[model samples]
Target: MSTLENDSLRSALASTPRPPRASAASAALTFGWRGMLKVRHVPEQLLDVTITPVMFLLMFTYLFGGAIEGSTGEYLDYVLPGILVMSVLFTTVYSGVALNTDLTKGVIDRFRSLPIAKPAPLLGALLGDTVRYLVAGIVIIVFGVILGYRPDAGVPGALAALAVTIVFAFGLSWVFTTLGLLLRSPSAVMNAGFMAIFPLTFLSNVFVDPSTLPAALEAFVEVNPISILATVSRGLMEGNAEAGDLAIVLATAVALTAIFAPLTVRLYRR
Candidate 1:
């Protein structure tokens, strides 16, 4: 309260400079690193992508192989790519679940109070999820190879399929991210996510030939985005990808992101 003390405080304050603002990229990366750390601490959640996919691969291949394709080996070759697409899409459900968890735990409010880039946390969390997708793909492919599934297009083809799956998953995540923002409960978001996914994956040509189905069902499965993804993935790994199929998957992913990303941000702000 003294004049001398006030003068000294003013001098010190004048001498100190404000810290520079963080760049959007840097802020996003910092949050991305945080997201990675969350994965490190909660590694068990990975079982959804790893063990579950492997189980599906095994059950579907061995149980239905003889009846569907006359042999396990033949069925494995035809089904592995479709299984990969299903697995990757299943993992995307967690994007919304994680977002909902953070919102409910008050983390989003805390982040909102910070001076960092607005989209940093959202983008960073999604960026970290890219690792999950990559790991799941690698595990499934390796397991497939061990089980006598050989990609005709070989390693490069497998890698191309992996890349496409990741790109699509990245875009598809925004749809869940928006759900996370709008939903009140993480479990609700998770349930809703699966409800949306089940028909897409199961009703697609993931296990059976669409040609064997009724004309109406065959037409529906053929045009489904999940079916298109399976077609593209099977083609890529089989060394027979059509340009139009690949283009459709890419366009679908881009469209999903374009529509949902802004909606998620708007919901967050409100």
Candidate 2:
């Protein structure tokens, strides 16, 4: 084409108006779907939500159930809720690992060039990771049922218990998301997250009764966030939901999100 025609085409393109950046909610969901697609491409990413939970459920129930609660059946009743909490907590580490991978690999650089909300990637990762927790919840419930475990609170209660756990896990992901941005490697993110969460899950009332612990340990368990979560889940699923325990769990989630969400945003912007 002649220079005149090329100049005319360039002028027309420059005059065209582009749409505004998408709303944070819409961009978040879109990127969230993208995150889910990543899971499809890497099926082994699901081992934490699937294989790990099943193994924990089986090992904990059969091996130590009788010793801890005097019979496998009775222990299964008491253990399912706590195991569900533990499963989701353990799986949350993957959020940090995935986020760190994206950052280290320069995926975030491509995102920066796009006209989307800055927070979309982080929110999307957290939203997508909810599916992982949901899968773990289902695995635990199905295995518990097959093993003769029954929730006294029935379906609605069990669902409420799952919802509570998912919400808490969602908030907790921000803590790791911040680590993913600040840390140099995905492995470092995983190690740091595990170091923070392992003691919270194990030292709390997840595997055993708080009363059975020593005085100092029991003191920590009583106020431990995991203990609050386990108590809320057990109470809700067992038809004894206490207003106080549920309140504590909800408060803990809110506090974690409030503390870490801004930190993650700040670090990611840097």
Candidate 3:
């Protein structure tokens, strides 16, 4: 190397101040913004997240509303809450798929190489996914409004219901995030996630009344955590949420986060 060039390089290094380390929150928010950017570039990813709920809402309300709840209007009111739950929950599956994709593509390894909180990537990814849940829920509620389904509880009630649903989705996302870390492929993560969600949604009071089921099945449906969540959602939007149900829903969210979040961190570290 030329002496003049080497000295100039040394002077530049000596004059430039080293940037301070990023705070944990700052690092996490940066990754969360990165996650949001991915959605911006790949806006097509929202097709499934949106289309399913619209289809379910329309099909169920028109096809079976009269037979099930006596009319489409009444059934719209009855089924919208359940549809919101199903729609938002379906979006959670992608959290794992995205995480798995990052891992497979070595994006996560690049995050690991950065000097940041170890859990920041996972937390930020999950945080960004809250947008998907928001999108799904809003689509259902707005469509339901267009279809003449009104939340008797009005705006505050509807907002409260949406808030609870988002919180629930947020808590449940850890399960998929953990799967993302453990599974070898994004497809596998998705398959396994929907396998669990489908049964929970179908078996719950999300669609039909538990009364229509066989006694044993009805008992199971009544006790199903998904059923409880749907009931709470229904009640909140409908303005009749039982205190006990709300407590149970919050407690369940806490339990899921408590169990799966640490497990995700453990697996991430490994």
Candidate 4:
């Protein structure tokens, strides 16, 4: 080629930005699909997602309902949302622990060497876990119905409630994934993570009414994200459609996603 043509080609190549790097979204999807495929093989994790919710619903609604809320029917109505939130809380911690396991086992390093999307592993872990969350939700809701915890809301409202729970869970996975990336041990991550969530769930207006608690506890419950999420779920399930509660739940989810998604991706890139 002529010198001028060669020079022009080099100049164009230099001026063009490398094609915008592939995002973690595709990577996340791939990772999520892989997890789903793995689940198909083992099928045991499905038990945690599907069966546990039913057991909790039955145990709480039938066993503790009368003592807690004066009637089985009344307590089921009150506890169903709490149980749903608890299920999500329990399931999301796995994301961090799983990521920690991959890191400890050198799986993460292998992933880093591949020319894959930077955020795929983290995103995939989050997405894959959503399957478990959905299964839990389905089980809880089905059993709730069987136990006379009929959602006053129509089908659409119920679906929206489920959507809120999933979105919240997704955001939470990001938080746990970041922790997993930061921690040296999976056990540490699991224990510390649950320690944090346990308080957040219990301190909220989950099983019991916030007003019935002491003033100090009531104040905390009023502001707690878990409480707000539970309120959103209740609103949707009960068909009360409280705009402020839903807004708070959505805002919390978005804020968490904004904070942790970028943080996890940054850590993964490192």
Candidate 5:
């Protein structure tokens, strides 16, 4: 290398100042805003939230309402909570898929180069995805109302139900975000997510009474976390919420965050 050019490079390095450290909250919100911008630019990113709930609410209520609950009205009341849970579950996978895509595209590398909180990108993506989850809940409730499904528990009850679902959903996102960091492709993450979610939400007492299942399967359904969550949502929205169901839902959220949050942060830093 030429001496003058080498000295110039050295001088430039010596003169450059490092960027200041960003607070965790600020960094997370910054990246979160970025995540929302991505959704804005790609409007189709909301198909799951916008279209899936309508289809599921209509399909499930009409197809199985009579056979399962003896009437469409009764089934609508029973299934709407389940559908809300399902909607959030469906959207949570996208957090992982989106993260995987960002990693693949070298976006993480850019974030790494910046002077920001290490967990900012991940936490930000999750925060941004909260919008999707909220929209899903609103869509299910609004559409169900149009189809003659009313929450007898009223607005307060409905809001409480949504609050529980959102808390659970936020904790659940960590599991998938970790998967995104570990997986080779977004498709793999999505497939694994659906495989896990479909069974948990479906096999639980979401659509039908757990008593109807075979002895062993019914046992699992009775204690399934999703089942507990759905039960709590139904109770809250229907004015029959029990302390036991609320306790179970809170415990599940705590357990999920305890187990997955550290693992996700570890993988994210890697």
Candidate 6:
């Protein structure tokens, strides 16, 4: 080959891609565990996961239960799942905020300079935040049980419901993570991102029945993904598994993950 052609061939050969290894998983786990340890240093953030669930359970079950659902027992049964879903939804917003903070503080840049896997920070954040979701779910369920909010589906079913909710939250963290990376401002990302989801939770079946809502609001509640998730959760807890409800919730979660995971990875790469 000519010198120019030989030089080009060598460059192409050197640029050939190699398969990624299992070490990425180890890096993800290590970074995720590091995030968990960071949370230990700032334990106050956990208060929302542990305490707010109990407080919301009590507030809704006793204060507004009679006025809305006619009895505290019935209302507790209805709102418990909604509270669980809402707690996870609200908690997921912090993922974006935290991501933005890391970017602002150059923490992500420092990680980028390391030899770790590209997805480590994002994956680790998702895994670490899952602890928050579990704490929130357990506290809410335990308080609900104490307050007579028995799940008709028993322990296994309750656990399944919690698992679905956590998976949904984990998928949602990708969306927030992407937003955080794109925005690069913690307060702006959090406020605007959460503002978008606020109506999704409030306008849904969280505190009221869709059938009782005004026609305009009822249409929104019917279409809201949060409402669909809440319905699926309630169905599981109440042992009334409907094919349509489960399908919708699963579809929404899968769709969100498909859209956000690639976007999040792209953001991380950038």
TM-score leader: 3
Tens digits of per-residue lDDT for model 5 on 86-136? 898779999999999999999888988877778888888899999889999
What lDDT does candidate 6 reach at residue 222?
Answer: 93
Error of 6 at 247 (Å): 2.0
By summed lDDT, the worst window of 10 consecutive residues in model 6 runs over: 15-24
Q: Whole-model Cα lDDT per candidate?
A: 0.92, 0.91, 0.90, 0.86, 0.90, 0.86
Name model 6 segments beyond 4 Å from true. Answer: 1-22
Between candidates 4 and 5, the one scoring higher on lDDT is 5
Model 2, stretches more than 4 Å misplaced? 1-17
Model 6: per-residue lDDT, tens digit, 52-82?
7788888888999999978988898899999
lDDT of 6 at 266: 86
Which portions of model 3 miss their true places by more than 4 Å? 1-3, 12-15
Using all chains and alpha carbons, the TM-scores for the candidates as numbered come to 0.94, 0.95, 0.96, 0.88, 0.92, 0.89
Q: Write the per-residue lDDT of candidate 2 for residues 77-142, one digit (tens) a residue.
A: 888999999999888888889989999999988987778888888898888999889999999988
lDDT of 5: 0.90
User: Alpha-carbon error at 169 in model 1, in Å?
Assistant: 1.0
Candidate 5 ranges beyond 4 A from true positions: 1-20
Residue 120 error, candidate 1, Å: 1.4
User: If both were scored by lDDT, which would come out higher, candidate 3 or candidate 6?
Assistant: 3
TM-score of 4: 0.88
Give the alpha carbon lDDT tens digit for every residue of 79-170 in model 3: 99999998998899899999999999998888888888999998888888998899899999999999998898998888899899999999
Of models 1 and 5, which has the larger TM-score? 1
lDDT of 4: 0.86
